[model samples]
Target: MAAIQPPKAQYQQVAALLRERIHDGTYTADQPLPSEPQLSAELGVSRQTINRAMNLLRSEGLVRVRRGFGTFIRGVPQVTRDAKKRYAARNQGTGAGDVEIKALGLTPRTEYVEIGRVPAPAAVATVLSIETGAPVLVRRRHLFANDEPTQLADSYIPWDIAEGTELLNRNVGRGGSYTRLAELGHGPVRFTEEVTVRTATDDEASLLELDGGQPVIDITHIAWDAADRPVEVALHVMPGNLWRLRYDWDDPTADEYPTVDGEV
Candidate 1:
């Protein structure tokens, strides 16, 4: 067979078509996609064009590539802002008040490699409402989803509460730290989150599997205790292309809600 020329626009069109199929349930989540040769034949495009299209889909999080396995549709579903707000409300009274963390629908697996008392930095101390240089129990974590590093979180708990508790010695592989804090009587009653878009650092890029200088979403959150004292500060960095942030606000007095915020 003669070598087929690749068409860039055709490749993009193929990628868009595949994305639409995935969104509309034509290609179900976690199901293996047609092989490149098969897809090329079906779409009437060259295998090279199919390959490029698949790459685009993968980067856009519509598909996943396994080392020894074929490409599969990514199973994680996107949560809209309204859905997140509903989730947050539902989790308020439960022990799993960190439900927003779960609603992202990313499977979280944590490795607790270290737990020890360290002098709190000035910034951390200010957030925790403690004296600067106070002792705090630091928990270093590598958080993963589908076995891929999704977040690297460091949690700081005051030493007076955390060091003596089982939280120090236990390995909370999944739903560990947050659950333990709830058990330790410092469960978060309120949370404040701030989001910003910024370039990833070299270390962040390596750990989060992101391209250097690529834009990523930075979520800084402070979880507060029942008494409104800050219990933890968590920094989450997500691949900008793979995820989105959503928020919802309601004005109860208004008879009709206005969607004038340019959101949605």
Candidate 2:
């Protein structure tokens, strides 16, 4: 005889039903979902059950809760960060973030958070091969897609490299920072990025418009010039549900393990 299956918990059932409704267009991106009380009444469940279901959806990033507004379905991610082409695109004058946003027919904007020389943070100093607390030019900005914030980017450059240059300005002009670095003979020819995922902090959740306890993607990027010296270090944070990271490269061991004729 076949084994019997256990019934789903009340919240799981509710969440599954709600998820189906969302997928079937009963809920949409342009409007908020019905209030919790209304959902409870319609589903003949307790308000607590409805609240639990909502929390599950929030964790999955299917919906977001606003302070004074009702929950709303989330749109698809607006950025695809491809490691292979990111540097190549930057060399052409725009960063991969802006290029991807524009490719999706969305507007991209950058709001400067800070632009000045300051003592480098401990981590940043280590990455830039500088003494702790050494002065460095820091450019911090918030990247937006349309009106929604997408990323917080903070870049650090050595004092000697950034001094007396437009890299210290609010607007670094057409090609952005990399072009300026090139002009200074420190153009980046290689890059390395370390990526991690973790729950968002209170400030990160607020800035990214994410529900509390939501996850986020953290990245630390280092750029090197032809001379093999680190030219810049940048830190990036983005909402986990609103970004996709892609990487592609040829296998380094391909030549060592060359395929023989009729190998199969």
Candidate 3:
């Protein structure tokens, strides 16, 4: 028999009960939790205690409060972003992270997509070797994993390269933009990425449904063509709590040593 433990504090007891429900699937990711008054009446706790418990869960990254919108449980981080595999899949004609998420049996989708010509921002111009304020084709979208918003992705390409191409379409179809670039004879032969972590801006927090003060992973990626010309620049911003990045590469020094015995 389990030991008879001392009673938990009112707020902690409330939290424990809610956490149990969350884990047991009584409260799923798609639905919001009961209102404070509802929970208070059901659990026979003071509204103050319920609020305190919710706040605790929010701080733990296990729940999110959407102001007017009710609170919702945040499930475990279910997406692993393996950089090498994503690029490799793209080369095989997969688009928009579909293959990666599908492999996990989760739905990957772009909830919002906008495409048009915009003057290049200074930073984007520098990366694409174009003049600031020059016309450039941009595609921006909000990506989702199942019903959960995952990331914001934006891609920029020089107007000369993007004009009249399907890259300007809201849906670039399978294999994504890279495959389209390849058809134009500018397929990316090399790529580079710069990654950083920082606090989310208000707009970012709203879009990704992140709690205030939550951090985000920002990635800047550039693709180069066979002529060594910069063909595309992309920015991907993701909620820091919901995803983990992965990188794998062969050891550089291994090539320097053929064998321990110095054989051919």
lDDT tens readout by residue for model 2, 134-223? 999999989988778888999999999999999988878777788899999999888899999998899988888988888899999999
Give the TM-scores of the predictions, in the order they appear: 0.59, 0.88, 0.77
Worst 10 residues of 2 by lDDT: 255-264
TM match of model 2 to true structure:
0.88
Best first by lDDT, ranked? 2, 3, 1
Give the distance in Å from residue 88's predicted Cα in candidate 2 to where it truly belongs: 1.9
Q: Rate the local accuracy (lDDT) of all candidates.
A: 0.70, 0.87, 0.85
lDDT of 2: 0.87
Rank the models by TM-score, top first: 2, 3, 1
lDDT of 1 by residue, 144-227 (tens): 665666566677888877877766774543445556678888887677877888887898877766544556777767888898
Better by lDDT, candidate 3 or 2 = 2
Off by over 4 Å in 2: 1-13, 75-78, 91-93, 258-264
Model 1: how large is the Cα RMSD against the reference? 8.4
